[model samples]
Target: MSREPMRRTIRGGRPYFFADPAIDKILNMVVVLGSEVWTLRERLAAFEAIQVRQGGLAAGEIDAFDFSPEQEAKLAAERKEFIDSLFRILQEQVEEARGRTARAPQKPAEPVAARKRAVPVRGKSSKTAKRRSRR
Candidate 1:
């Protein structure tokens, strides 16, 4: 029997459950890169088609076209930079939507105005009567 690759059954895993935000960040980056790679593949197909049509190159040759050292290095460097940037963004997990946002300590709530004003205790007593709030 053939086994199916592991599949995420529920919207992929939840990133919030982990104590470390890095996991979430990296996971998100992976998803983004996956989409980008698909986009690149589609573009590559079109690019190769154009090259074959106009340059009269065989599909296989165009597919394996050689790049000059400078071009090759540039592309390699660009890919490295993209991956680095993606990870760097992960490192800065504070900006991630699912990451815990540092909220400024909420200002102590102002004392709510009570509808009833405290009246001086009658005969040294401590009970006060409720009064309607003043507009």
Candidate 2:
């Protein structure tokens, strides 16, 4: 008796089969890692949504929230570390997606209106008005 190989159909298209065990292992690992990363990001987004609903940083004075000075400092440090770690992971994912060995850091685009200097409106000269008053 003969047995056929297992196949995978992606997006309801044709079925594809992988013959190499190593390739299959790598592919499965990537899928799992990607899903885990996505889940973490979703959870972080939900936390941010809750923060927004609670009025965020603009709610009131820092003291208005419920932490002591030491506890607030510790929380700030932990938050900073978490942000840094997340940024590192995001950079790695971006590099991987772009198929680049090194991540190309992008500069933020400046707003066109913000780049322009504000022009003052024309008005009667103060010196001319003073001379007219003297006359």
In order, the Cα lDDT scores of the candidates are 0.64, 0.64
Runs of candidate 1 with Cα error greater than 4 angstroms are 1-15, 54-56, 68-135
**lDDT tens digits by residue: candidate 1, 1-135:** 899899756786654745888887788899999999999999989988887899866769955879999999999999999998879856543343222223324445334453123223332321112112222
Against the true structure, candidate 1 reaches a TM-score of: 0.36
Question: Which TM-score value belongs to model 2?
Answer: 0.31
Candidate 2 residue-wise lDDT, 59-119, digit = tens? 3443466888999999999999999887886765454435322333474544667434322
Candidate 2 global lDDT: 0.64
TM-score of each: 0.36, 0.31
The best candidate by TM-score is 1
- Off-target runs (Cα >4 Å) in candidate 2 are 1-16, 57-135
Q: Report the lDDT of model 1 for residue 12.
A: 61
